[model samples]
Target: MTRLGVTFVATLCFACDARMQLATRTSDLDEQLTIPSDHDLELEIDDALGKKHREDLDRALDAREPGEQLEHAQLSQLALDRQVFTLDDLFRVGDDLFAYQFRPEQGLGNGLAGHVGIEAGPGAAPNLRRVQQNAFGGPDAMSCGDCHAVGGDDGAGTLTQNTYFRGDGDRTLESDVRNAPAVLGLGPIQALATEMSSELASGRAAAIVMATTAGTSVTVPLTAKGLSFGSITALPDGTVDASHVTGVSPDLVVRPFGWKGHQPTLREMIKESFRVHLGIVSLVDQQAVRDGRVSSSLYGDGPWYDVDNDGANIEVEDGMLSTMVAYLSQLEIPIVQPPDDPSLLDRFARGRAVFDQVQCGTCHVRSLTLVDPIVVTHAEQTENTASPTVAIDVARAGMRPKIQAIDLIGSAYGVPLFSDLRRHEMGTELASPVEQIAGGAPIPKTQWLTRPLWGLADTAPYLHDGRAPTISDAVRAHGGEAQASRDAFVALPDDDRSALLVYLLSLARTHKLVAP
Candidate 1:
């Protein structure tokens, strides 16, 4: 269980005009976001104020065009196809693709806007991008940048950007709501998960062997990366009772993505996202269709090239997914930013102490070490197809603002993501309306992975459903396993409570100038 990400976004709100445009409160450099050429786009960024800063963001997205219309994104796709990494080239291509807007002509939806041939209006083309909620998916966004543009190009989203997943495909009530999460330092996150999974597997295997040899039941503590996920009971009968297992799923694999800890690999997350979030199907989708896991082609059962019913074929290329993975995996990690004022700084320090005092650090582990910094990614491949592999040392290939340490608590490097990478029963107060389908474990509606609090302040409107508007509100909403910490927080003095809030606000993304 892990969700590690950050970006250059601050939650402080400033005054804006009556139009309700988004104000770039990050920095002066954020005012002029540089949209890379070659991957130019022409968009109709909306002016309607869906949430806090969306109007201005939509306007900004619309301004990202380079005059010429690159129909069907052919030029950008060509550019991505040629970028086979040298790490440098992957970053260059990924940087552009992360913010590239998609139009319906490029197959951006299955049915969010409507069926494949339905008209939005008098002359509007079919499958016009809409933010409507549904069971199958919202396909509610035009680009990754649309929802992720809270504080940066790769930041978390506002409540307006929340989407309902795993639903009835028609009604919004039957779906699971999810907030758009920030994406940062994903390469190393996968690396850490892989290492931890191996360690847990070895421990479980040892427990099984011991149980068989001794002809008695044995319980093994599934510990990994210094975090404890309780113990699993194994019997000589070859049955494993995971009744006491905490955090991780039944199999002891540490999936590091999704609020529910669903995805095991970053590439798989990207591949699913392309099809579910955006209508652009990947090679994985094609394989899923062949295996009868999902239906492709909205109309005539699309050929292998086009999975979505949209006219475009091979909308998202395999190489494009690979480059995007490289780009997202290398995004900047979050940093602690204390206030400059003496009083506030004192409050922040005290709040930091209070954070530990209230046992918030138990689940939100202050530091977790990444023993192996090298991350391997595989291109889209089926059981029969060959997938190219790209191995990158995130410590070297990652963007700036790396979380550095000397001894690193007896590991290769420190990743201060402030999470134990385990799931907890969040209780009925925060339970999803739907049980939902996820990979690995049978996650109940009341369970959720401990979201990494590295960029807590930047990603406002907290919680899986984006129900909490502030950090304090988010803390108050905690139930189940976190109830003790929440009770401790409630018992604090008024000033200490304020101090605690101040300290949590310091968990923000550091200042950096980035072009998309």
Candidate 2:
């Protein structure tokens, strides 16, 4: 067998072993619980559990009277005991879990615990003072699914739901409103970014080594996804000169998650969202505060250990956070769904050609290849061990889906995420006054990452701020590096323009519970 085949077999065997170990652990836990043999009875139990917790939550909220405050332990116990059926239970289940997390629900307490009443205002709830002082924008929305409900579940946001960021407590001024982009197909996008970053870093490192050994200045062109970031010149004395670097970090890492391409990883994005949107801090962020790496002041005016001061040091556990990331990473990429009408299909085909002709593919390059597919596993570690000795299939983490076949657009794994994952200088019209800081450096106000066009049709109210309501508006809004392409698009005849739009619309993938 080929080396690749051998490696594949070995990995498969390891994964299967991990799953078996997890099953054994799960069986042991099941033995401890007085679970019903009948499936219907089990569901009934789950519903009863959910209902009881809801009642407990209400009682806790009531206790938060003028002089009464519920402790963290009371709130923690009130959080519904998450049902674990299969290994997938370790993470989030796409069906009801997705629905529950996204859909707006009553009595679901915010990060402040049941301290603040569900209703907003100081007069209505005594704990409102604590909320107003601590929480960001005072509990902006109930669930993440609430805001991102435009095209479908986890879709883009509307103008009304625009997130006001970087403000001094007041929403009227000193804050910039940003529209939430769709979270679909992020797994492949992240994988592609990781690969591209490694390539750029390796190139710079090799250039630096050559310069130091040869005692001469060496220059390395920084490139990723066929786009040039800039060049780095290394001197003989090992002093590196990066005066020409642009878009990406001097370290050559491409962070392709946020609007400004700021977040290095999806995990970081999730952590920040918990703090900013939900006003919840992850265990990881809490540790950063305790170690004095991050200031406690940033988390708001609360207890040093428990920022929200609900007495819970950890707002969102690491395992829960990891599960959320896994759920997001596994979201299916949008697929091309051409209209059944022959005429429309023809138009879509023509528009696709026009899309290439207009050079939109230059920046929004058709597709990217993942160097390594994302794989996450959860397990316990033995004391004094350097690494985890036992592997377990938490959320079926060890069982990765088969990589999708490449499409005509050149997307590997059949994910038509049309983006080069590079930052470009958008013209003044689309530029924002607020500068996005990433890796301790401020990104240019006008610079933005190439928005992936995979699910363009579904994600309406386009552009960074949802300024453009249609795809055509977004196309016209393009400037700076995209000026020529935008001009070409503008000059196109009516039929051709319509065809291009049709083709873009075809990129919308139908929503599914799980990726096939």
Candidate 3:
């Protein structure tokens, strides 16, 4: 209701590349800005939220003061819709957002422990109430940069930044400890997934039609973008036997984000991250209140929907998600930078050959051909009003050194992503203690998403969690579907193995060198 700053709504993006530099620099407001890692909410409680007309919600707000404020108003989504801001401008704004450190005054947190979003109702992760205050404890991080600062901007998180999700907030062992993944080249990844899902759906539909027409069972190999995803058998009765289908969701959709690959779109993934990591609810979250999905913590007669009763309405505005996606989609792609030295370069080549020799490329495929480069964002009517989309050509229009731009508009090129973006059984060694509950159902404990290894060299402490300190350890820790590759890597000669590591280490992300 009481919107601030920019004309309409847009924010929460374009960092990780610019975040570390900004985050490392001290700010004048640094001393006063902090989320105390303690459940000492005794001082947070406050008075009336203006009226008795909405007595129950207001009383709840008063009791749980929430104590949040907004320092800067968000940018309007109209800026992108009306072409008032260019792609570069959107990226720059998103960068500012990604680096902006939130304080209590700017509506940061309302309990990530003991509850998910400062509440104990249907929204709470029931067992997680008395968890650690912050520091991988709950939604206690002050900013995305706080955790995503280890390797580079939008890089992997270190041990300190690991987060415990969907568990008893009090204890570390009871929760899911996840290492924050690098947030680079997400647009193409999501696009590839979208295309894959469509192809799979079409394949399934064709099988169904054939089966119905022929009045017999029709089995078809599930191929998308030239790779096989096993097969599906369709019977004449319009029933599909998907048990033979491999490596994808029951819906046949590929989720390129998350350790378990549950998220479908950048908008959904980014919004979820803000809520789970920063306690900042977006307009989409407000929609949850209307849908009776997530509880509404409305405070007083404000025009904006207050999700956590933090009094900071529209914390992450409606349009911010779209631009953020645009910014993320355009960030620089990772490069296969081999060492310059002759011996080391030789090792890199050997490792590349060995990578295939040992079959690591079986799942960690060297590259995938993307037929189309256009990644469209914000095409849905999420939080009501202004459902506009910006289509970015992933092969062009990004923060320079666009390494993967060879496949120009409407062309196909190999994306050296080193991932199939499919789920695999990681065995007990790499598996988590508990199954990750996503979209209501529980994902199997051993099934893990194939992490894109484009930025592999920079993202430290590998694996689903940050258990493996080095890449070698991560390789040995592999099991289930990757067990064969892991064993082969282990049995390799010392020199061969070293060469393999060199090849893996070559998978580095590129950053601009700025001379100040």
TM-scores of the candidates are 0.79, 0.73, 0.78
Quote the positional error of residue 213 for candidate 1 in Å. 2.8
For candidate 1, lDDT tens digit of each residue in 1-516? 011111122222223331122223212211111222332221111111222143345445556853122222222333443544477667655655566667767566642234556543212222433333342344666677777877666889888777767665555574787888888767767887899889888888899899999999999888997788889998998778988888888888888899988888888788667666776667656766767776543322445555445556656665677777777777778876665443364576578789999999988987778777877766554542355466777777756666565473635787878888788888799998766455534688898988999888888889998999888889999999999999999989999999989878877775543322
lDDT of 3 by residue, 1-516 (tens): 112311121132234323332222212212111222233222122111211223344345545654311222135665556767777667755665676667543556542224334553223321222233332234557777777876667777988777877665566675777888888877778778988999999999999999999999999999887788899999999889988777787678887889999898888888877776776767665766757664353211123365454556557765677767877888877767655443354566578778999999888887777777788876343643565667887778765435353434645756778888888888887777776555455668899888888878889888777988999988888999898888999999999999989888878876533222
Question: Per-residue CA lDDT of candidate 2, range 464-502, in tens?
Answer: 888898999999999998999999999999999999998
Candidate 2 runs further than 4 Å off: 1-87, 90-138, 377-403, 407-414, 513-516
Summing lDDT over every window of 10 consecutive residues in candidate 3, give the lowest-scoring window: 1-10
Location of the lowest summed lDDT over 10 successive residues in candidate 1: 1-10
Order of candidate numbers by TM-score, starting with the best: 1, 3, 2
The global Cα lDDT (0 to 1) of model 1 is: 0.68
TM-score of predicted structure 3? 0.78
The segments of candidate 1 whose C-alpha lies over 4 angstroms from its true place after superposition are: 1-84, 111-135, 169-171, 237-239, 291-304, 382-387, 408-411, 514-516
Highest TM-score against the true fold, candidate:
1
